[model samples]
Target: SRLQIVCWTVLVISAYLVILFIRFLNAATITDPFNITIDWHLWALLGLSASSAVGAPVIASAKAAKEPAPLQQITADGPRIDTSRYPAPVTKAAAAFSRTEAEVAATGSGVLYGKAAPADARFTDIFQGDELNNAMYVDVHKTQMFLFTVIAIVGYGALILNMFLTTTNPASLGLPAVSDGLVAILAVSQATFLAGTGVTNTPT
Candidate 1:
């Protein structure tokens, strides 16, 4: 998610710079009253960046919907612990392994995750199981909402500044007056987003 956001921010900044360069070209050629127009390039940059910012909520929401509801799966049967129930090891490595080593690595008394089940049936606890099922979705929703709020605030502020710099009096402020300001604004936006990503990914 952090990578995606950074990529999107770079794209947005690049597009903005390109458009600003074009505007410079326009400003240089056509004189009088600083008539400026934001063409396709400007709109496309905004669209792509805005979409990327919005994608977090969509992805998380979709995942949340698809995940199975957490529940304690109870069975009517009891434990069947018998020495005869144990099966012979299929491979040479398994047959040679001692009892203690297997017990350490296995999920239960002796069964690794994503492998064959243990000889004795094990049941998961309600609290841990519930956390596993719902954790991602819960985090996704929270983070997505935060992302949207930040993007919206930052984007709108930048937009307002851009409009002021572009449409207002350029002659009074000189040729490159807005250039440094624009760079500063974009730098802040990217920095803040990167900081947010770090905060989000930090271990608790």
Candidate 2:
């Protein structure tokens, strides 16, 4: 749920940035034939997109199954206890205990115990059962968003580095120039993250 909230928050921020980007494109003119203008706001948008991409799978991994009640289960059938073999005092104590309590006592000391919570929610683990298929499907999308974000970061970083090294203007070094193709890539990455998460259009 927190991850969903974060996704929604990022969505809202991106929507505002989209409006700003469109306005900038309409009013501003690009003088350089080789360089394209990209603002700090767009960079901020890309960062947010990357963050959302990486967070999705982590959130899914944290949604562990509820821990079952104590003594309700044991990982194995448990060790056998011979009531007749026990000393008089031990036998007396065992006789008064309830079945559940007795079961716990017998198995609790052994190596076998209840299963631990899942360390991560892998797709296969969630997908095998019909009840968890929806969650599995969602996680798959989240994984895609994560991969996209990683690629965007690498590509965007390379472009920025190129601009910094090649350009003379201070503004170019700071805001940098992005190719039309790179711009499309960044836009699509953001959109993919938003769509995969089903984030609302409304700004927060």
Candidate 3:
């Protein structure tokens, strides 16, 4: 969400700068060369992204706090956690004691309670689930969010370019207005992303 906000910000500012440059070159024909404005809807779109970025971590952390840490065993294929060992409705004290005993008995072994370092990070990680059980699976929420962000950026860029070409005075034109429908699409996309973070299939 933060990344999307930054991309939109840079796109708008860059487009504005290009217009300013054009106005500078054609100073004789234009009045108020630096008079550029950003639409309120654009600001709202950015605000939604910023809100999602801040809210996602908070939701995840809240969910994590209520769950007990699962003991993970480093297998030949990958790290695997035995969910059966820490059954549901177990008390916090019992869970803690069980975790300690498992840690001691498996000290020399590969069993542990932490994430293993990835051999290498990839951009595909963005579309993959963060949980152990579903890490290999593609995250539908993340993929949709990424696709929408790319589409929004590309579409807005083309809109700005067309405006610059068609307008008699590029400097006189305000920033392109974002439609209410596009803003709503982004809002729903971000809301779903946050919702997915809060509701996890795996135990923490």
Candidate 4:
């Protein structure tokens, strides 16, 4: 889960920084007490961070793909099937909404969808029916995440460009140092995404 991954990342980074701090304290590096040591070996941290950046979204998409079919919640005994409410078809429009029992039984013109006919002679032929049947489909959390990811990539690129053009450190532009900013951005982004679940009542 994202929460577990986030917590573990925080703990690992915190422990690494604490170890560095202790080493700084013990090594008589106090002449510039505020200064910290970070070698290029920290590139390993960057590499892991980059891997997770790519892996997280792929994991989320695979999980979404593996979600149980929506119809699994329905059962034969759950709802009484009433053909009365399902009026006979008026005219053949589309394969999904075209089959009438009379036409099907007499002329053998019916279409079988996944071994079962769709109710009401509507959506009688297509497997899973229309993908856009739900108005909220386009507004799902995944779409929002994807859009924000693109925005973040563009925004970060712009920031890097500005820093290069200005010949000034991030601190001069009221930004946190790179590592701290990365941590803060990831934490906030994760929390924002999680908060949307509460607001939207979306299942994890």
Predicted structure with the largest TM-score when compared to the true one: 3
Question: Which sections of candidate 1 miss by over 4 Å?
Answer: 3-11, 26-137, 144-154, 157-204
- Please give the TM-score that candidate 3 achieves against the real structure: 0.70
RMSD of candidates 1 onward, in order: 16.2, 15.5, 8.8, 14.2
Per-residue lDDT over 1-204 for candidate 4, one digit per residue giving the tens place of the 0 to 100 score: 233345435544654555445445555534443344343433443444455555555543443333222212333779743424432222221233355534433432122112234344432221122111211123344344444444544454465456447743222222212455554554455545444332312111
Per-residue alpha-carbon lDDT of candidate 2 for residues 95-181, written as tens digits (9 for 90 to 100): 433324354234322211211235534435321211111221234444554555556545655655565467554323244334556
Cα-based lDDT at residue 59, candidate 1 = 42
TM-score of 1: 0.26
Whole-model lDDT, model 4? 0.37
The C-alpha lDDT values of all candidates are: 0.37, 0.41, 0.68, 0.37
For all predicted structures, in order, the TM-scores are 0.26, 0.32, 0.70, 0.31
- lDDT pick, better of 1 and 2: 2
Residue 166 lDDT in model 2?
79
Q: List the residue pairs that clash in candidate 4.
A: 96-123, 96-124
Model 2, runs deviating above 4 Å? 1-44, 47-131, 134-140, 164-172, 179-184, 199-204
Best by lDDT: 3
Error of 1 at 183 (Å): 16
Candidate 1, residues 38-150: lDDT per residue as tens digits? 34443443444465466544543433333221112223685543423332221211333333424322422111111235553333211111122121123433344345535
- 1 against 4, candidate with superior TM-score: 4
